[model samples]
Target: NFEGTFNTGAYASWGPTVANRVPVHASGPYFIENYRAKSYAVHTNTPSSGAFRGFGVPQSAIAQETAFDLLADKVGIDRLEFRIRNALQNGLPTATGQIFEKGVGIKECLEAIQPHWARANAEARAFNAKANGSVIRKGVGLGSCWYGCGNTSLPNPSTIRFGIKADGTIVLHQGAMDIGQGSNTVITQIAADGLRVPVHSIKLIDGDTDLTPDCGKTSASRQTFVTGKAAQLAGEALRRQILRKANVSEAASLEFSDGLIKAYEGDTSVEIELTRLEPNAFGYVFMAEETYDPPVKALDEKGQGMPYAVYGYGAQLMELSVDTKLGTIKLDRITTAHDVGKAINPMLVEGQIEGGVAQGIGLALMEDYLPGRTENLHDYLIPTFGDMPEFVNLIIEVEDAEGPYGAKGLGEHVLIPTAPAILNALRDATGVIVAALPATPDKVMAALMAHNEE
Candidate 1:
């Protein structure tokens, strides 16, 4: 028989303890169950809760994924198999009672990771069965969670402008920022392909509010899909305008390439330079602009809504070692699989995954907030070079029709499953379970002590 248990946690929002109302926020109530107990951010004399790298997914994964490893050990099931059996699919209902509309790849992700997981799990098990002779036990664990690709319940939109200059160059203007994730490059690619122009012929003016359209913030992985589409539509519109102004026949299609507009059936072609395409310039012809808006709704008191326009999924496996005495954890290797719908840039997607895993490692063994306070990054520690582990980044490309070229956002999906995976491995190695974030030496030691006492 197939079986699984799902748990969730919530954050309580009391507007400062002095406020005379019960905090009805979903977060406080949501995480307590996942934490195997309750945790409250009582309207303290301090600050409130907010989103970070992994959002609510990280908090939830940290608890349930740890529990998953414990459950796997008890059932004697392969960890990977355990995950696949319970992996959320497209039609599955989420804990919040919402059905996924499209682009769910939780199963696909598990399938992609099967081979690597088998090999890694074998190595971890073999080493644990017979290796260093000590109280220290080496194990492997995993963590995974689901979240929509962009801002949920928040207004998400993008606008872009495309114009052809007198010199035949294509100019694209957008409000998206690069921030190191290649947003600018991808937007240019979409415009070039749409206008039929050489990639290099497109000049992108982006992230300047005064010079570009309102493309929304760069936080969510929405730029490439949302803003990129706007750029493409604008380019297509400009292409139509050019043909209309040139009085070309319907059959006189124009091929856009290398900044040149050529009559499809004739030797006539004109190279347009972006500088010469200024609206104030003589003979400057076509201009087009467009905006994109996806349907979304607000959740009522139930803490539900079309929070995400689209969702991205992933699965991961970890091979790790825990020194029972030293109370230190070592991550030997990690195999991560994600469904990105389309990898506009495979390298870029890999980068996003790798970076996210780094953050995950931090959450599992290094990152921590000072007790009773969320402020001060200086006081809050995150993983550094000492924590980097071997990573097997796997990109499971499943074309998402709503995304650009079938590409969905890969930004936040990578980190969700890592901590749990590692924690599970730890349980496998030592037959002991630690339930909390940053399973530090002190915490692990405490668990070991408690186990020995038992």
Candidate 2:
């Protein structure tokens, strides 16, 4: 059973949305015989609780995973081993009763990190065994996450438009904002692949209302899956039009250059002059606008349905040392294994993982919101580059049938496991469980004192 109460402040902003989303994700990616989840939005006299990276799921995961640690200890099973055994596999239904026949990769992620978990724990034990009269103790812990790719049983759709001008220059009017998540690069790559053209040959336009279509808002890690699918469809539509005009077979190869198109299939070649053709009212000889709404079904009163068509899965292992006296944690390493369906851009995925890990550090050790009392940057701390540890990334791919080129969402999944992993590591170093956000030095010291007294 899972229950959550959120202090959605004065305005209540996205409280209802979050209230609905948390319960659906509260189950994580594990299988249970039965579970009931309820969420309450309590009015508070604090700042407005707006949307963050993981919505309310991160907080729910922190509570759930921390509880799992206690359960694992009580059952005499290693924490990582316990999760792997219980990790949701293919054909296992979710809390919503949505059973995926394929594209379920939580168990794969947990298994992928097994070697890393072994190494981290071995190093920690060896270091702790030799720590005689030392104030520092090493510990390692694991955390896993599974995130649905879109909104919770809502009508969220993405539309993309692309057209070839008389000069043969392709202008892709995409509405999905980049927001530093590499949507521009990812969407363009998908579009290019679908259109059978070079990425650089196509021009991308975003945030321009007059030129771009409504590609939906940039959240829930939906751009790569939703908007990208739309872009792929649009590109295919435009390619089909060109093929029809040339009277070429579907197997024909395409070549797009300035003011012309060349279609070749075995000895049959067809050329279309772009400059000679009449332009449409949108000022393009050929254009395609396609919309893709991820298949979803509204949950019943019991919150059961296909809330999201695709989901991302991940596991992470963190190794750190806790200064028993100072209650400070020094990071040593972190290994993250995630099933992204497919990586459209490997470097961007790595950047996302590293950035998410940094945010996870803040959520685990700092970045506490104190409402009225905490007004300045000094009051709220964040992690910097100097705070990062040795990072290892393991990209897992379990292709989704609905995704474009077998690509799923990666933005939110990377951060969900971070905070819990850090807290679990802290618990390993000092037999104290911190389910709360931002385990500050004072809180750590207090928990340590309690452990010592016990």
Candidate 3:
């Protein structure tokens, strides 16, 4: 049984949303049949609480994963093996009672890092065995995550609009906001595939309501899964129009030259002269608009239904050393395996992983907000370049039929497992559990002192 009380702060904001989401995802992407979770949100005299990355799941994960470690100790099983044995598979049901017929990759994610787990743990054990009462000791920790890609059981839609002009100018009106997550690039790549044109050929337009279509908001990691699909459809719609005008089959290869489209199939070829065609109201020879909404079912009061069409899963193994004397933790390395369905851009995927891991570092050790006093960046610390650990990125592809070209939402999934992995590693290194957030040097020193006394 799991119960959570969330301080919603001075106003509502996403307090109710956080309350609703915590219970559904608190189980840490594993199979939990005899599971029960409840959350209560109460107003406090602080700032209003809202979505802080994992939408309250990160706090729950930090507790849940550490609890798993304790349970593994009582059962006399290796923590990694214990998790692998009960990892969720293709036919299992989540805490929400939603069954996925396919696209379940949590087990794969856990297994992907198995080889490293043994090697890293052996090294840590060897190093600590030689520590012989030294202030520094090494330890390894494991954490995992499973997150839905879009709105929970709500109608979230994205539309992509594009057109071909008589002058052979191909313009794609991308509506998805690129809030540093690379929506602008990822969506364009997916659309480019459908249109059979190079990415450079498509002139992209965004942030202008008068020019762009309604591709929906950039939250919940929905731009790639939802907006990308819409972009694909829009490209196909225009391609079909061109094929019809050329009186050619869908299998025909298209070549754009000057202001004309050449459709060629075997020995037959047809040229679509753009100058002979009439422009539409949007001032294009052919224009197409398409929308994609992920399929979902609303949850009843019991909170059971198909909340999301696609889910992203991953696991991370953290190796670190704890300076028990000074309460300073130094990350050695982090090996992460995530099921992204497809990586439209491998560089962007890696960047997202690194960025997420940076945030996780802050959440685990450095960042602390003291309201009036620690309001500024200097007061509240963030992870510096020196704080980042060496990363071994392993990309897992478990294609979901719902995503565009088998790409799922990855923005939030990368952050979910990070803090949990770090905290678990802290425990492994020093044999102490941090019962609170920001795990500052002072708190860690105190915990170490109390443990030493015991």
Candidate 4:
């Protein structure tokens, strides 16, 4: 059983929103037959807890993954094996009773980490054994997670508009905000591929309400899956129009070059001059507007529904050393495997994974918010350059049927498994489970003393 609350009653009467996410994400990613979770948004004087990177899913994952580690120890099963036994797969019903016929990669992610897990365990054991009377102890821990791509059981759609200007220029209206997550680059690539045009030829107008259509907000990791699909469809639509005007079949190869659209079918060819066509109201000879909404169903009285069209899966392993005397933990390395369906931009995917790990390390070891006392970076600390460890990201490509070019969302899923993995690693090193978050030095020392006394 799990219970959570997000209090918003203090300002609810004034139109403040409540905790709409706690109940949906409290179950985490695995299936639970007899599980029970209760969540609430009550009135309080403090400000409301709004959506963060992973919404409320990260909180839920912390609770569930920590509990699973403890449970695995109690049952005398290998932690990794324990998770594998309960991981969701095809034909398994989620806690929400949503059963996926395909594209469930939880098991594959778990398997992908086996070699790394074994190596880390061996290295940690060897290091700890040699430490002898030294205060340093090394350990390795694992975490697995799943995340739905879009809004839970709701319609969140994205629209994309692409046009070929009479001046032989291609313009794409991209409404998704980048926020430094590389949305601008990735979506443009998808659009370019769809139009069969060079990436440099496409001019992008992004996030301007006056010029672009609604691609929705950059949340729920929906841009690559939803907005990218819209871009893809718009590209295809424009391509079809071009081919029709050239009187070419789908098999015909088409290219845009030197202000002319050329189509080739074996020994025959046709060319359409860009200047020969009249411009539309949008100032383009060809234009396409398309929208995509992931298939989903609303939740029932029991909170059961097709909450997401697709889910991304991941497993991560953390290796670290603990100093018993100083109550300090140092991370050595992290090995992560993510089933992204397809990586539209591998570099961007790696960046997301690394950034998530940094935050996860902070959440597990150092971050704590004290309202009055902690005012700035000095007090409310985050991971710095010296705090990061070596990272290995393995991109797992399990195709999603509904994703744009078989690509699912990777943003939120990267961080879901991070904090829990670090917490479990702390337990492995010190032989004590720090139930409270952060596992700060004081709390870690207290838990160590308690374990030693026992």
TM-score of 2: 0.98
Off by over 4 Å in 4: 7-19
TM of each candidate vs. truth: 0.81, 0.98, 0.97, 0.96
Off by over 4 Å in 1: 1-42, 47-50, 72-76, 92-102, 243-260, 265-284, 301-305, 371-379
Error of 4 at 53 (Å): 1.1
The lowest-lDDT stretch of 10 consecutive residues in candidate 3 is 49-58
lDDT by residue for model 1 (1-454), tens: 1121222113334222111111111221112222112223333333444445655456556666666656665799876677777766566555344566567677788788788767776776677678657665667666665556665566788998887665565678888988888888888888776766777877777778888889987765678778877877877777777766565654456655544566653665444333444464323357788987756676556544566566677778787778888788887788888888877678888888888888888887867765566577777778787787887888887777577667677777677778778777777777667776788899888988888899
Mark the regions of model 3 whose C-alpha exceeds 4 Å error after superposition. Answer: none
Rank all candidate structures by their TM-score, best first, as comma-separated numbers.
2, 3, 4, 1
Candidate 2 lDDT over 133-224, as tens digits, reads 99999988788898888888888899998999999899898999899989999999999998988899989898888889998888998999
CA shift of 181, model 3, Å: 1.2
Per-candidate alpha-carbon RMSD to the true structure:
6.0, 1.1, 1.3, 1.9
**Candidate 4, clashing residue pairs?**
7-42, 9-42, 9-43, 10-43
**Top lDDT model:** 2
Count of backbone clashes, every candidate in sequence? 38, 0, 0, 4
Error of 3 at 291 (Å): 0.6
Residue range 318-406, candidate 3, lDDT tens digits: 99998888888999999999999999999999998899889988998888888778768878899999999999999999988888888
Model 2 residue runs over 4 Å out of place are none
Query: Deviation in angstroms for 375 in model 3?
Result: 2.9
